[model samples]
Target: TFKYVDTDHDGVMVKGELAAVFDYLDVDHDGKLSYAEYTKYDGASAESQLTHDVFNHFDTNKDGFLQRTEYVDTLFSQMDHNGDGQVTRHDYDHFFTNVVHHEMHQGHNGR
Candidate 1:
């Protein structure tokens, strides 16, 4: 999930991109992602829920706070959609776009 969002794969999800993801999930615009904000991004669909699930999974192992490895690994798994251990900007953009749309939809529905 982090890899999908983290295009540079620098081991940390950037504020700009992370903020985008948060905006998508934080339907209420509360400026932070609570469990509910996180849940809004999750679902049964792979495209919709993969990144969010991976984020949550990583968070659980390390105090529910995401460090660089957790961020990178989550993103790496997402960008490496084919599981070939590499990623391109196309993958990152695609995933990010999806998340943004998903978040917008959630916000509309929540309202």
Candidate 2:
């Protein structure tokens, strides 16, 4: 998956990697994500308040759609820790490790 993120094979990650993610997620390739495209679950997912909250969290532009930059920038905020616009492997590892660690220590094991 790192290779997928490292599209340039340069060992560093820029917003382009996240751009690819946005593209893959843009089911219709319309350059933006609709509510359904973003939270595709059962018939009620798109109408759920939690889904709306999550979608609005990433729709920073308040445009009712998830723009590519909006999606990428939202994630990049956590990945690009040094403000250099590039996420090294270390950054990737640290980010996920912390995420996993948080979940692991959140009191639930495996249900």
Clash totals in order = 7, 0
What tens-digit string does per-residue lDDT give for candidate 2 at 1-110?
45667888899989978787678778998889988777752343776654575567678789889998787887677778889999888888886577534544452445
Candidate 1 residues 4-108, lDDT tens each? 456467754444565466557666664444554465553424345544554465564645545444444565576556675545566556666785456656755
Candidate 2 regions with alpha-carbon error over 4 angstroms: 32-67, 100-111
* Candidate 1: Cα lDDT at 18: 52
Q: How far does residue 76 in candidate 1 sit from its true spot (Å)?
A: 1.2
Worst 10-residue lDDT window, candidate 1: 42-51
Q: Measured by TM-score, how close is model 1 to the native structure?
A: 0.37
Best by TM-score: 2
